[model samples]
Target: MAAELMDGKLLAQEMKEELKAQVEELKSKGITPGLGVILVGDNPASKSYVTSKEKACERIGIFSDDTRLPDTITEEELLSHVDRMNRDDKIHGILVQLPLPKHIDEDKIINAISPDKDVDGFHPVSVGRMVLGQETFLPCTPHGCLKLLERYDVETEGAEVVVIGRSNIVGKPVANLLMRKDKPGNSTVTVCHTRTKKEDLLTHTKKADIIIVASGFPNTLTADMVKDGVVVIDVGINRVEDASRERGYRLIGDADFDSLKEKCSKITPVPGGVGPMTITMLLFNTVQSARNRLSK
Candidate 1:
């Protein structure tokens, strides 16, 4: 039998329905959850992502303050905008779109945002809190992946899980989350990366009951690499040129879904998989941040 599709789009809709009720209740209590979004350049993909986030915020009745800046803006100018958002009483969560212009310092900008309002959860404080397993904003993509595993009953406890990337954003954070001493955690995680020898990589993957691949490269994981009945989360999204399509390209994940589907017990598809959940979780963090403000 083919692997069951872990439909993130459906789950995101369900989560949004729950969030709508939470937002309504917060409004009844005189608190409107607000998100301040900053986009530093006009990269088409980044713009599209930001637009989706704004739409998601609107759908759930959360306030969004969007700032679109030119590619020429200096690091100092961007920092000023971040500082402005930090002090905005109505804005509970702040998100700065990634891949800023070459001239700007990404780390400095991320560090400038207040941890309390770092909805993207890229700030150092948030990372530290996540490592410590404290209640803090979890990185959206990683958080979404973990949520999918939990909702789908993936049996993470003590599972041999291999994560195929080590980036701070998805791989590292998700690995940390999986090993935490908590439900949906307590799994033994081995993270494979570019540095891992080919044989060593296979050795780790062959025994993994669960694998989360986020290497940003297509076909990083295949059917032969994972065990039968494995649960796979494909986090990589790479565009491959396809002349037959109108857009001239298609999105694919790191895992070879066709081959892997026949072997693995479960998997998440590209485009409709982790992508939707990432945005939904961003909205989740924003709502949670607003609720925190209300309690303060």
Candidate 2:
């Protein structure tokens, strides 16, 4: 049988419904969870992402504060905006949309966001806490990947899992996350990066019961690399040229979905798979931040 499609759109909707109820409860206590998003430059993709987050916030009764700046904004000026958001009592979570203008220092900007309000979980403090297995805001994409595994009932306990890619965003955090002694964790994980030899990568992946690919390239995993009965969660979203499509391009995952589907027991599709989960998890962190604020 072909792999059972792990439907992320359906899962995200379910999560949003839960969040909606939580928001109603918070409102009764006169506390509204708020999210502040800072978008730099006019990148169409970034704008689309920010818009989706805003819509999601609206749906869940979370307040949205958006700041759209030009590519010419200075690093200092951008940091000022981040600082302002940090002090906004109503804003429980602050997210600086990534890939800021080339001139801006990403590390400095991420470090500027208060760890308590770092909903994106890119802040150095948050990343450190995650590495130490402490309670911190988990990065949205990685958290989403973990949640997908849990909701689908894929057993990770003692599972030999291979993670392709080692970037901070999806790969590094996820590799560390899955190795922790937690319900969705407790797996032996091997992370393959650019330095890993191709033969070695396939060797590890073939032995894996779960394969998570975040390498930003197409065909990073094929049937030959992963064995049958493996669970595949693809995090890459690369656009390839397509003549038939209206946009002249189509989105694709790292794995050769068509070829790998027949071999894997479960798989997540691009666009609808990890993408929606990422946004939903961001909302999750936002709500959690508000909840944490009350406890403090």
Candidate 3:
């Protein structure tokens, strides 16, 4: 039997509907969830991502305050914008797009955002809180992955899970999340990076009941590397040239999707999979921040 396709686009739409209702409820309580977005450069990919996020905010009725700064802006100027947003009572969440100009210190910019409004969940305080399993905003992509598993009714508790890649963004955080004593967690996780010995990597993968590959390279996890009935989440999105497509390239994930689908019990596809959930979760975190503000 072919694997059950985990349609992230469908799930994201469903989640947006839920969040829209939540936003309306917040509005009734005299609080409109607001997000502050700062784009520091003209990088095309960053611009596209920012646009998508802003559109999502609109659809969900979250107020968005967007700032576009030239790449030539000084680091101090960037920090000042973050600080201004930090003090803005209406702005419940602050998001500074990553990969700023080379001159700016990315770490310093990330640190400047108040942890309470750090909806991106990249601040050191948020990361530490997450590591300690305290309630905090999670990195959107990894949080989206967990939502997929939970919604699909995947049995994660005590299951053997192998995560490929070690980037702070997806790999490390997701691994930590899976081992927590919570729903969609309590799984034994093994992370394989470029440095992991091939034999050891194979050993862990072959025994895993679930594999989440985000190595950012094509075919990093092949069908042969997993056991029967495994669930695979392919987080890597890479562009590969293909003359057959209109765009001259196709999007693919880290796993060998064509083959893995035949052998796995469930899998998420590339463009339609984890991609959609990321933005949805970002909206989620922003709304959550607004909800938190009501308690104060």
Candidate number of the best lDDT: 3
Question: Model 2 off-target regions past 4 Å?
Answer: none
- Candidate 1 residue-wise lDDT, 213-293, digit = tens: 999899889888878999999998899999999999999999999999999899999978999999999999999998998
Model 3 error, position 280 (Å) = 0.8
lDDT of 3 by residue, 1-296 (tens): 69999999999999999999999999999999999999987999899999999999999899999999999999999999999999999999999999988899999999999999989889999999999999999999999999999999999999999999999899999999999998999999999999999899999999999999999899999988889899999999999999999989999999999999999999999989999999999999999999999878
lDDT of 2 at 204: 98
Could you give candidate 2's per-residue lDDT for residues 244-272 as a string of tens digits?
Answer: 99999999999999998999999999879
Local distance difference test scores for all models: 0.94, 0.93, 0.95
Q: How many residue pairs clash in each candidate?
A: 0, 0, 0
Instruction: Evaluate model 1: give its lDDT.
Output: 0.94
Model 1: what TM-score?
0.99
TM-score of model 2 relative to the true fold?
0.98
